[model samples]
Target: MLSIKTFKPYYVKEEGNYIRVVLAFQYFSLLMDDKVYQFVPLESREIRINRETQAIENKDAVFVFQKGKKYNRITLRDLMCVKDFQDHLSKILSPYMILTQPKEKRDEIDYVIMELEKINLLRLIDLALDEKDQIKFNLYTEKLLEIQ
Candidate 1:
């Protein structure tokens, strides 16, 4: 079964042509590839990071979506879509960058591998929604603040 237990929720920023709003929340699927299956509140795609480095022994992160199915271990840097088809897109961030001048344990760690075990810190990117997409976000954020 494709279980919700397999995914992690995260919020992210997204930029669009007409407007911009937070993605509210999204789901990252733990898979052989470091990929995200985003539930975008607006019309945009969300990006997930892979935690494994074995499948990518000599490659970088990637995402693949064709027909109505999503794929992992993709090798592309970017994907584009028009406004009409916006909403709930999948993606992966590859060629993971180790930005530190000095090496760290987190460097070169495969994001896909850790996701399967439930603890991970992959660099997932969220899409900010454009207004006219949802009317309940403000209320949601307020509720979040109450608990925090």
Candidate 2:
């Protein structure tokens, strides 16, 4: 069975009107068009990291979608319908200027990442409709708050 996991995109690369986001398992691209929404899969994409510039690239990757039932087109409306999609997108796309600086700047990036995760956890707490889940959320929040 195929498993799905939600993750903040590892990195993004822009080419023309297309933007490719490297996820944990694959490279997913989105065409920058207001009228349509779809994620194109770049197969056999080789990731290369430039040591000098600290840049990443997908070498020999074709800018095309895979063909089959599994590659069914996804619409913007469809993505919006998923719970917390907006929150996820907001967190993922936030400016990462802190990451571009030297290693000493990593702490700032780490803090941002932590804050986003905390916000997400709080949102999940709101979505926990059951008493059992609510209790778990309460405990988790208490523990998290203690640390903070």
Candidate 3:
């Protein structure tokens, strides 16, 4: 019988049009016939999911597994055929799929934050100048320069 003992992504990254879920041996492992097999990155450790559809794009992606010196390989397509495996994988990936923001949206948010910071610094600089505080004025100007 095949079962998941542990299944957690090592890290999740946003690529151009996809989300890459990277797995590591220490984080992901499964049980097969009562033996635990650690996942090996092999040629590729990343599983790509489409940003638009939130569907896994690399269903045919192969993963290598090892137990001591013995090695085995399986494609994601085959693994998903098992009901338990599919359900568990879906639960784990659901949050990532739902929470991913578009790159353009993220960039816009970042720009807004930078602008707000600049405005706040300018206000502080003005206050420092009004109070005739030389030290604060210099500090605020340095920060403004760095932001620019």
Best of the candidates, lDDT? 3
lDDT of 2 by residue, 32-147 (tens): 23222234543432234343343334443433333333344444344444555455555554442123467758888898988987887777666764455868788768866864
Alpha-carbon lDDT of model 1: 0.31
TM-score of 2: 0.27
**Order of all candidates by TM-score, from best down to worst?**
3, 2, 1
lDDT of 1 by residue, 47-108 (tens): 43323321222123243322226433333232222221222332222123223433445553
For model 1, the superposed segments whose C-alpha errors exceed 4 Å read: 1-5, 18-27, 31-148
The true-versus-predicted C-alpha distance at residue 40 of model 2, in Å, is 53
Candidates 1 and 2 compared: the better one by TM-score is 2
In model 3, residue pairs whose N, Cα or C atoms come closer than 3 Å (at least 3 residues apart or on different chains), thus clashing, are: none
lDDT of 3 by residue, 1-148 (tens): 8888888889888877778888899988889999999999896687788867877888989989999999989888877777777776677667666566889999999999999999999999999999999999999999999999
Whose TM-score is greatest here? 3
Q: Clash pairs of candidate 2?
A: none
Local distance difference test, candidate 3: 0.86
List TM-scores for all candidates, in order: 0.16, 0.27, 0.60
